[model samples]
Structures are given as C-alpha cells and as structure tokens.
Target: MARNRKSVARLLIKAPVYLVAAWLLGFGFFVLTLPKAIPDGMTPKSDGIIVLTGGAGRLEAGLKLLEAKVADRMLISGVNPVVEPHELSALTGAEEALFTCCVDLDRAAPNTAGNATESNLWTQTHGYQTLVLVTADYHMPRSLILFRRAMPNATIFAYPVKGEWPMLYLANEYNKYVFTLIGEAFKPAPGDAGKQAKSATGTL
Candidate 1:
C-alpha cells in the first residue's frame, strides 16, 4: 500500500511536466511546419478568392490575384463593421469599379471560422466551386482547417502570405492554432462565432 501511494504521488508530479514537454514538442512541430511563403505550385487560379481580415497586405494580395484574372470574384471576410466600402477601396488601391461589380465585403464574420462560414455562403450564392484562401502565414493553418471543415464540398487552395514575425507573435498564433485544431476534432460543423469574445480585440 505504501509503495502504491508513493508511485501515485510520483505520477502526479510528473503529469504536469509531461504535459509541458508535450506542448513544447507540439509547438516546435507547428512552427517548423509553418508556411514560409506561397509555393510556386499554388497557382493563383481559382473560381474565387477569400481574403481573411485582420492581417496587413492580405487584401492587396487578393486584389492582385483578382486583377491577374485568377479568380472571378473576391471576398474580404471579417471586415470591420465601421469600415465603409469606399474606405476599403482606397486602402487596397483597388478601383471602385472593381468593388462595384466583382468584390464583396463581409462585416458579419468576426473570426477565421466565421470567415469560412460566410465565405461558404457567398460561394454558394455565386456558384464558385474553387477558392484560394489568403491570410498571414502564421494564421494559414488554422484558417485552412476551418475552411476545409466549413466548405468540404468546395475545392480550396491555400495562398499564405509570409511575413516577418517575432517569436512571441508566432508562439501566440501557434497556441491559437492548436486550440482551433483541438476544437475542430470534436465539432461536427463550422460555427458562425468561433471566438466571439475575441471579436472586439480584432485579428481573431
């Protein structure tokens, strides 16, 4: 009985250490697998483009793809509710005419999951079967997972925009990415509000 009690106490003490070690290992794998840049094989051609909000230069990249005639339509999901359409046109240096006919701004989605859900709806409305997803490289993994889950019937391609990021930023994003993966393992469907509390904080 005494030996059993001692063994249990030892196991309890090692449990947290094991967990921390496992987390560090997983984080290392995540960082190593992060996309360094958009690969040459990932062509720009798709029926539509999905530019997830909250990252610098993502909108411009998507617009450029559209301008290059890779995609017929572009959806800038998760646009701030207060941001006017005209303001986005100016910010992206895209002609207002493009926005008038080809681009759609989504202010309803507040996070990656919402972006996927709303983008799926927009694609269904437009009948776009193939889509290219654009977002910061650090965020591309989680975005892809949620997007694939949300639009399983749609052919989706990843177009991660690489950025120079500090280790802290990478670590923080890694945690969120892991969290998203874990949540997705059990959730049967994509949600409209994956991170509602983080909405006001921006860059959810």
Candidate 2:
C-alpha cells in the first residue's frame, strides 16, 4: 500500500511537468512555423479580401491587391466605428471610387475571433468562395484557426505582414494561440450563422 501511494504521488508530481514540457514543445513548433512574409510578385486570385485591423501595412496591402485585380471586393474588418470609408480611402491612398464601389467597412468585430465572425458573415453575403486574409505575421496562426472554424467551406490564403513585434506581444499572442487551439478542440460546432442568414436573405 505504501509503495502504491508513493507511485501515485510521483505520477501526480510528474504529470504537470510533462504537460508543461508538451506545451513548450508545441509553442516552439508554432513559432518556428509562423509565417515570415508574403511572397513578392505573387498575386493570388480570390473571391474577396479580408483585412483584419490592428496592424500596419495590412489595409494598404489589401487595397493594393484589390487595385491589382486580385479580387473584385474587399472587407476591412474590425474598423473603428468612428472611421468612415472616405477616411480609409484617404489613409490607404486608394481611390474614392474604389471604396465606394467595391470596398466595405466592418465595425462590428472588436477582436480576432470577432473578425472571423464578421468576415464569415460578409463572405456569405457577398458569395465569396475564397478569401485572401491579411493580418500581422504573429497573428496569422490564431486568426487562421478561428477563421477556418468560422468558415470551413471558404478557401483562405494567408498574407502575413512582417513587422518588428515586441517580445511581450509575441509571447502573449503565442499563449492565446495555444489556448484557442485547445478550446476549439473541445468546443462543439454551432450551426452556421452566415449560411442561415444567407438562406433568409435569399441572396448571395
């Protein structure tokens, strides 16, 4: 009985250590696999482009892609409610006509997950089968995971923006990515809100 108790205690103590080791390994792998840059002179055609806010160069890149005719439409997700389309046009140096005709502003999303939700809705509304996702390099993994979960049928291409990120930012993002992965694994899939909305609208 004493030997069995000792064995149980040993297992209990080592269990957390083993778990920590596994988590560290996973994080390391994630860091190594993180996207460094979008390829130069490579324009991937998609049904639309979705740019998540909170990083420099993303909106401009998406706008350039749109101007290059890589996609016919673009959704700037997570826009501040105060900002107008004209303001974005001025900031991006994209023509006002382009913004008026093909660019959309989404002010509903407040975070990355919310960005996915808003993008999914917009994609369904626009009937976008493929999307070029623009965000920071550090944010791409988690963004991709949530976006994929939210829009399983859509083909997503990552266009990560390379930047000088602080160590703290990288660490926080890495932790969040791991936690999201674990949470997603256990969470049950809810019915597609976008599809339901599309069905009701009877449009794209």
Candidate 3:
C-alpha cells in the first residue's frame, strides 16, 4: 500500500508538467498553421465581399477593403436590423450612398452558418460566381467550413481581418477549434438550423 501510494503521488506531480507541455505544443501548432497575411492577388472578380460580423474589428476591416475597391459590393452579415444605413455610414465615416449602393445589411443570420446562407443568397442573386469572405483571423477556419457547406459551387477566398492581439487571436482560434471538434464528436446529429439553412440555400 505504501509503494502504491508513492507511485500515485509521483504520477500526480508529473501529470501537470505533461499537461502544460501538451498545451504549449498545441498552441504552437495552431500558430504555425495560421495564415500570416492575406494571400497575394486574391481579389475576387466574380462576386462581392461577404463580411461575417463577430470580432471587434471585422466590420471595420471589411468596410476599409470596400472603400479601397477590393470588391464591387459588400454584404455585412449579422447586422442589427434596427440600425439604419445612414447610421452605419456615420459610424464608418463613409458616405451613406456608399453603404446604400454597395452594401446590404443582412439581419437574418445570427452565426457563421447564417452568414453563409445570407451571403450565398446575396451572391447568387447578384450573379456573382466568386466571393471574398472577410472575418477575423481566428475565425477563418470555421468560417470556411460553414461557407463551403453553404456555397459548394462558388469560388471562395478568405480575407481575414487582423486581430488586435496576436496571442489572444491564437488562443481564440485554438480554443474554438478544440471546442468545435469536441462538439462534433458528442453533439447529436445536425438538426433544424443547419438543415434548414442548407435546404433554404440549396448548397449541395
């Protein structure tokens, strides 16, 4: 009993070191795999810009890109329906016509999947074959999953917005990735939201 107790105590001491090492390795992997900068010459010629709103700086980044002529039009997903276009223009400091002409305030979507559905509709209706997806750097991976599932045929290019802090962004990216993996493993099969979004958009 005494020897067994010693062995268990030793294991407990070593367990924390192992856990710490594993976490550092996982974080390092995520950082290494993350895209350092926006890809060169990724300007989409077929479709408009689809900006998913979640991170603090995502919308501002998307608007700046639009103002720079990165794409012909912009779809700001997850917008609050009550906010007026003129209000957005005042917030962005761009002309109201810029928002009215080249932008659509999508209020239906409340998440990434919704962003895909709404943006897909906007793109298809506008006859755009290609699209540039803008979101925070940490969100690009999961965003790709939802977007690809929503718009299987459309060419998609990711234009990740720079985050405020590199460490925080990396932490968020890996945390979301792990959470999603676990959620997929144990969560019951896809239900109404995903199915309805997929069916409504017809993204087979």
Candidate achieving the largest TM-score: 1
- For residue 61, model 2's alpha carbon misses the true position, in angstroms, by 1.5
Per-residue error (Å), model 3, residue 56: 3.7
Ranking by TM-score: 1, 2, 3
Candidate 1, residues 1-204, lDDT tens digits: the string is 999999999999999999999989988998888876665545657899989988788998888888888888899999888988789989888998998889888999978889989999999999989999989988999898888988888898888887787889888988998888788877756453555546756863
**Model 2 residue 154 lDDT score:** 90
Clashes of 3: 0
- lDDT against true structure, model 3: 0.78
The estimated TM-scores of all candidates read: 0.86, 0.82, 0.71
lDDT of candidate 2 over 1-204, digit per residue (tens): 999999999999999999899978877787788897877658578999999999889998888888888899999999999999889989988889999999899999999999999999999998889999999999999999999999988999999988887878887899999889899988767565556777989964
lDDT of 3 by residue, 87-200 (tens): 878986788888878998899998776888888888888888788888876788778877776777888888877656568767866877777666556744536467778898
Off by over 4 Å in 1: 39-44, 188-204
TM-score of 1: 0.86
Clash list (residue pairs), candidate 1: none
